[model samples]
Target: MAAGAPRIFVSHLSGIAVFDPAGDQVGRVRDLVVMLRVGQRPPRLLGLVVELATRRRIFLPMTRVTAIQSGQVITTGVLNVRRFEQRPTERLVFGELLDRRVTLTETGEEVSVLDLSVHQLPARREWEIDRVFVRKGRKGSAFRRAKGEALTVEWTAVTGFSLEEQGQGAESLLATFEQLRPADLANVLHHLSPKRRAEVAAALDDDRLADVLEELPEDDQIEILGKLKEERAADVLEAMDPDDAADLLGELPTDDQERLLRLMQPGDAADMRRLMSYEDRTAGGLMTTEPIVLRPDATVADALARVRNADLSPALAAQVYVCRPPDETPTGKYLGTVHFQRLLREPPPSLVSSILDSDLQPLDPEAELPAIAGFFATYDMVAAPVVDEAGSLLGAVTVDDVLDHMLPEDWRETEFHLDEEVATDGS
Candidate 1:
């Protein structure tokens, strides 16, 4: 970059006014776009994402950016009127990247990344990330942050956590995206080119990969799973919610299904085998083998701990199954379930059996989809237990799984538009 090129924190750039040459006001900065290249070098700044008064958004290339002054950005590129859709090679700094957390390699301390600064490349119109601002303290409300702890550091000093590291490939991307929720991560991944998506899928740990897989479309699920080595693929499937894993596995050809199943842990393989045996339209097919199950004598505190697992879905976490001896499902005798509402009302020292909803009958393993839907509707339950004729708890069907099966077959391919107001960096 030129020795004296203007350098400013990204926050200062955000919301700055943009004008075309001749000083005609155009729009305001919504975010900055950068293309992550290969290796340790800083990513090249591509352009700015601007939101016009009409609420439409568009990309303004860097070549057109003549100067960036306090409160204003000047551009010479003709603005395209089309709505902004992020391309695979591009990432939005303010929208999804600003103020995320990262580990400083030199100090081994984790800090919240506050902003980044860019400068023009010497003799070239291109811009690149030059500095990173950070803060150390507690996180508060989603939007508001703690103050008086901020500092600036050279970007290279921050290591092991960035999606923008040029040559590091998937590892860099995973580090860069540590803070993204599974759904948001899925959205980002869905927009990636096939090669980038495959790299990310292969790099993610089994649990993280499993979570992202659940949010993706079936075709995406198939494509990503197909990219993993057979052993790792089986591991990820085993980590997934049983119902979701079953659904994805069912979509694969018989040969691939059998091969992957063979690589799974025996118990997990057995559970999947049982779930696969049922038609997708039936209760057996829709239920998840993993649920918060507690022995009748287990305390409310114990039940609460199980539900507190961060990985559990909202619906699955809403209740706990209180079963007789043998807590493992499919063999555990079905007693009844205790809703989270009832648990909180009871004393923590109370036994789970004291709060059991004994009268809430479980669904039959063979119950059809309509019956499953009606059960959820009739009882006003977020989830319902499934049981064999022998009264053994088979699994539990969550509302999300039921809706997945009930929704239109092509629902996954449907496109969605972002709402008007945007939150910076998913904050």
Candidate 2:
């Protein structure tokens, strides 16, 4: 849902038909899964449990959901068919929350939860249960009921759904550090005991866990991946960057790698296999397969839109690779590059081909670490496209990936106190 979209009551969502981007019905909404915070703060709407045509239920993350209107849910068409599994921190809106009595913070009068109103936070994809619809009455039995008064209140007006302050499970721990960056959270996980680490890892959502896993050491990555069910492990691996996922898969036994690869989407599996075919420190292995690729005929406006994606790393967004037909890497014949700055200066209607920077040679897929580093240094480029001998655009290598290969193996283990005080006057 877009920012400022109408709030939807959970009652209205239950049993609603769900459709993919192509307008084909995929499933029906089964339930909403949310994570309760430590206090009366609103719970984050994780996603929906959807029952497919085959009667198998799957989790549809809100990130993949594009619209909820006219009594139907629309998705991005990338549904994960794996069965929905509720974590320790998750709560089912209809199954568990509704009909339960929670006390109003001011009156101490208990009210039954009739429904919940969820709204997408402005400028963010995250949604939350921001309002509560409740009936002020004595507890009602399954068949008989006492309905005194019905009213709506802010989520904070009630108590009892939030986690206890003294809670010690991974749920509480996750709520405490919910705002930390993945790398910072990975550092926190690194110091935890093995049991605690696994608990925390399992509790995290797939996208989040994938990011944290990328920052964690190899042993931790393998250990945590092993503890998860194989289906879930494959899901997490698919969520990771293609290059990082391939690197992690390379650390596993070949049999184990193939099994997980078989579980992934065919295209993602293909990318992993292609990436793994190269030496670890080579350009092909270090580059991400999902860089922004635009056709020669695309306009400056088109390139800018792709660059503006919130998910793209700064380095990846630094420039766009203009290519022939077949935009996805390994794309059609390599054309040239269009830096973000040049796009801004060009008129929106101007074709990307007109402003191409073709003079700079693209990196070969087999380029070694030292050569790749020298190319970045000489060209002052944050990212450079990688092409095969046949001039097909393979992927783009960013400066960060080059540095990762150049750094000492134990560099991630070294502690740097970014918060340490610095002398102001050369004292």
Candidate 3:
């Protein structure tokens, strides 16, 4: 059988109804009695004990089942008429297994938990079978249980389903944020419940979590950080941009802030403290440690190579920043920045200084928020490098973070577009 496929296992007690060649009602699925091993191990399939209207139990071998579809089970041959044994309880409710993972023997397609469609036989309002519903068919209001609708096909919709990892449905879905754009990641974070947010974050790989955390709101960052497991929280804090790390730490309680800082690597802790030492609203305070630094004497090729090698988040700029060298003051001595796109089109061996745009659009360490926002608007730049008077680079301010100043309270429902594919029950 292929991996990550959808398959179904019918329980002995799974409801099974029978019909004759003319489709007349005959018998129903009774108990699926499997024999357990003498030791504490997995059980083996025995046979199905179906019930007939005659109130007698008929034993049928498992091989007799021909097909199962839309919740209906079919047998290969008709059985002798007899009374059925009274059932102690109703068959397992379909809703109980909606979000459960299944492995299909035929195909390897792994699908998320989605709604199921069921079919009801005519004249019998009680009998229904669950099956995969093609997305294209049943366009109107057939799925919706309004008046004149005799059937409810999508009664089996669940929050989510998994075919490979049985218990990882929610975690896997949320962990996909690592591959998403920053805006999309932010949108998903805002919609998740507090508990769910923590659960998903705990499951994410540390580096991926750091990437996603860079895009979340400060309030959300504080909430998620507080709820995360200690090790995971420390990892996220260590891997994040210095400015982002400081902002999150400032929002946390004093005790938590100290504890988390202690957990972080010393170098990372010092970097965050450096950013935090500045006034909160200034450009230096808002700057990140992720500026695209390059040697002034290096070739354009060298700068491009460094840009490719850097482990930056998605929202960062493609512009390569030029400085004399890491050992020298990068402030007033800065050469300029060259857009990687433009540099790639030029000759490879060209000196970076020749390609650099020396305009030096700099943000002062003490600049106010409005002044900084206007600077972005004036330059049409996605990011601007902050520096001190001695030409040493402090950090880079990203445009997306600046936009957070504009978001309203009801942002998630109003700003994000989501499909109604995953169904969550009130419970």
Candidate 4:
């Protein structure tokens, strides 16, 4: 935490904010780019990936960065709006090289690179990888006795991975994050470059990928979906909730939408088509066709089980609809809904119909956005069923979906800064 510390851990630099020379905030350092050099020499710093408050990322050359500290970075106040695209000669330190294996020059022992530090060299504008932190005896070496302490090595003492992606591919990246929840993985993807994002998306399973796509910003969602092969995109679309899939498809050109729909499961495609037929602002467009459905006589226990589906969001899972025979959604008749709170209060054996909130009227598929919002606010409900004239259930709109539509279209791309204050010498 010294003034413009010359040596620092890469992890500490990962999320630090970047500010302009005027002391006004710009954005945070999403990642550092370096140009890989010939064999045995450490790569030199090339630029920074700056993530703005709007969730959009831009590239800033190292020449534009004036200072670095534990919590903040200083920029020359020049920002390039062009997105970060990797040149063949460059590499990302944390994203591609961190946690990689390297051979120590002193002991000739293998170790995992734990962190690294870059320093401003002779020229005021030039920086180089001068130090490295490696976890010794990563598996079975005698240094394992150090008990989790990492050895700080100068960059010259170890060998670096040569691949642009650090000798790893999409599969390796996916395996590294397989344990993370879809939402967590989605968050990581949002901060990565488009190529890296596409690599990870290509490696995720259809269902897991579907979950993550739903959490991404609309533009990112479309881009990732576009990266998938048509067949696989169709599969992922099928795996996604009808409402999310519909919204994503609706964003594409009509022909592209038709092409993707053609490859989806007939049933899913039909549901998506029906949802898309309604105006994007209508209840039908915001609703998922596959809400938990209960036969009028289904027990409270059954209702609980239906909502327990892992794929359902909290709002979507908060209630179960009661319909006549053939209780699958889009059912015979929309009897009413049984809120989870009602189910828990009643005995496990109580029929869903026994606690149905018949007073909470359903919305018409064509109900406008404001009317739908009003229904949710007035009823204090997280979800409401949509029904047709025949009184048959069409779908259910969750509060989350309504909010997604309500927020400004560009809300996701705005840049923001943390409220914490950072003292700098303005070097």
Relative to the unseen true structure, what is the C-alpha lDDT of residue 399 in candidate 2, on a scale of 0 to 100? Answer: 91
Clashes of each: 7, 0, 28, 8
Which has the higher lDDT value, candidate number 3 or candidate number 4? Answer: 4
- Leading candidate by lDDT: 2
Deviation of model 1 at 13, angstroms: 10
Least accurate 10 contiguous residues by lDDT in model 2: 418-427
Better of 3 and 4 by TM-score: 4
Candidate 3: worst-modelled 10 consecutive residues by lDDT: 137-146
The superposed Cα distance between candidate 4 and the true structure at residue 288, in angstroms, equals 0.3
Instruction: State, as a TM-score between 0 and 1, how close model 1 is to the true structure.
Output: 0.67
**Which is superior by TM-score, 1 or 4?**
4
Model 3 vs. true fold: TM: 0.57
Off by over 4 Å in 4: 1-39, 44-91, 96-168, 175-184, 415-427
In order, the Cα lDDT scores of the candidates are 0.78, 0.83, 0.56, 0.77
Per-residue lDDT for 313-360 in model 1, tens only?
A: 899999988777677777568888999988888899999888789998
Candidate 4 lDDT, 132-159, residue by residue in tens: 8777664322111223457787778887
Model 3 clashes, total count? 28
Cα RMSD (Å) between model 4 and the true structure?
7.6
Model 2 score (lDDT): 0.83
C-alpha RMSD for every candidate: 10.1, 17.0, 18.2, 7.6
